[model samples]
Target: MPHFKLNYFDIRGFGEPSRMIFHYAGQDFEDRRWAREQWPEIKPKLVGGKFTGKFTASDTGASPWLEVDGERIYQSVAIARYLGNLFCLAGKDGMENAQIDAMIDSYKDYLNDARAFFWVKSGMGQGNLEELKTKFDEASKRFFTFLQKRIEKVGSGFIASKISWGDFFLADGIKTTMNFDEEFEKKFPKMVEYKNFIFSQPKIKEYIEKRPESVF
Candidate 1:
């Protein structure tokens, strides 16, 4: 196995899915998080290096990047898909994989919508607290309903019948979103169950417990 090097900030943003993927796959990798202040020095090298690239940060360029086996890989989704394929985490066959992809897409859309409303618009006067609450309430309800149905259909207690990249994606999404409030969890009991189920996985639990708590 190549030494998987994940580079990002300490926050559980982009690199988290990759970390969970590798952990669920029982793969060993290094999680490297840089402080915001350190980016000035590091950004230049990343831009000037062989895999020169830039991503948007605050409307400019700040992308989550990764380097696998000494080669650079940009974009969080691409990294997740690549790792999923490499580790047989995409599911069993073509149809199954496509289903996994659809689920991933759906989850991404949910996150994007939430980001836009909560992080971008809520406090900017573009929308008020009621508006934000309404948006989140609707989105979360829809997500919870869909996930509950999916789990029932699959009958496996997972988004996919077998473990796939979507599982990790959902796990991370559940963990992050649940930070909002108890009401969110109450409104989405299935999701809460799903999240707990993923966390209970031996490997995932080990990773969470053993992971360093220091802000990187």
Candidate 2:
């Protein structure tokens, strides 16, 4: 058995990347998910003195944590990076690693902006749909355009030369954006191609085909 345990809600959200990483690496780990209704009973036990004595984070309330080798690893990005390094999915060299970092940073910025827009427009009462749409349009165009150019330059189906964590990040971003607006592909053809290409990868395709689909 692997010495790793992943704890998160029964959704993709932040835990999806780590789950994908483990799957791609063929690593055996425990995937522990809590249902929404069961959270009341489970939360206290997971966070109480019993479990908390063995696992603790700076913020004990945070979910999507990784417990490995009897050590608690907090923060989603940190967990992803650690797994990436362990599985040799980061890059081959320092410069290549830097490229991965740049790509992940850009992707994170796009996600943050898109998520903000989503939260603001969800209520619809005090939100400005037009303004939020405009903001999303601009951010999406710039980020996807840059990604398209990078993929073209790399001449690989992935963001980096070889498969890396950033590729999954990019794929998830494209999937989320396309989910939000069906017309997203019409707006960005290159991004659409990129998304399809990433999905076509043997491991990724297999992962998607078998993984459970749930709303985050």
Candidate 3:
């Protein structure tokens, strides 16, 4: 097994999926986290002061990058997908794998659209809270509705026919959204159930219980 090191901000924002995959596969890794204050010192060494404000920032200049046997890999999804394939959380065949990738890509699109509302909610940006909330709720309903149908079509406990990276990605995304809304479960019962199914796994549950708390 190669030595694995994951570097990211202390927050779970883009790193938790890979961490969860590590635990699920029983792979030990160095979860190197940096506090916001410490990022300045480390940022120069990692990305050399490149801040694109894009989620798909260059791997060389992004948080949530990974190193395996000292070889670096960039981008959060790239890292998570790599771990997923490494740990056997990927589909068994080419077609299933393509479908899983398609699902993840769709979720990314939804997340990109939702980021504005999340920023305002976190107080990191300014916007009308009520208006954003209304818009987010509408958008979430659409996204979750599509997700629920996908799960039902698969007829498996996970988003795919078998356990795959899509399960972790989609579940974690919904879990994050639910953190801010007390009524989330009521509004999206099926999605909540799906999230619960993935999170209830023994290793995932243990990780979540022991992981450091973050407002995000």
Best by lDDT: 3
Provide backbone clash counts, one per model. 4, 0, 0
* Candidate 1 lDDT by residue in tens digits, 124-209: 33656557767777777777687778878988888777777778778777776776545777677778888889889998898888
- lDDT score of residue 100 within candidate 2: 79
Q: Indicate the residue-level lDDT of 155 in model 3.
A: 92
Q: Rate the local accuracy (lDDT) of all candidates.
A: 0.72, 0.77, 0.82
Each prediction's TM-score against the native? Answer: 0.81, 0.83, 0.89
Q: What is the lDDT of residue 106 in candidate 3?
A: 82
At residue 126, candidate 1 shows an lDDT of 66
Best of the two (1, 3) by lDDT: 3
Better of 1 and 3 by TM-score: 3
- Cα lDDT for residue 78, candidate 2: 81
Q: RMSD of model 3, in Å?
A: 3.9
Candidate 2 per-residue lDDT over residues 163-201, each given as its tens digit: 887777777768777766668978888888887887787
- Using TM-score as the yardstick, the better of models 1 and 2 is 2
What's the TM for model 1?
Answer: 0.81
| Tens digit of per-residue lDDT, candidate 3, span 1-216 | 999999889998888889899999989999988777766555444346644432323345558789899788888889888998989989888988888888888888877767778889888889888888888777787788888888898899786678887788888898889876778899889888899899999999999999998866
- In model 1, which residue pairs have backbone atoms overlapping below 3 Å? 55-61, 55-62, 56-62, 57-62
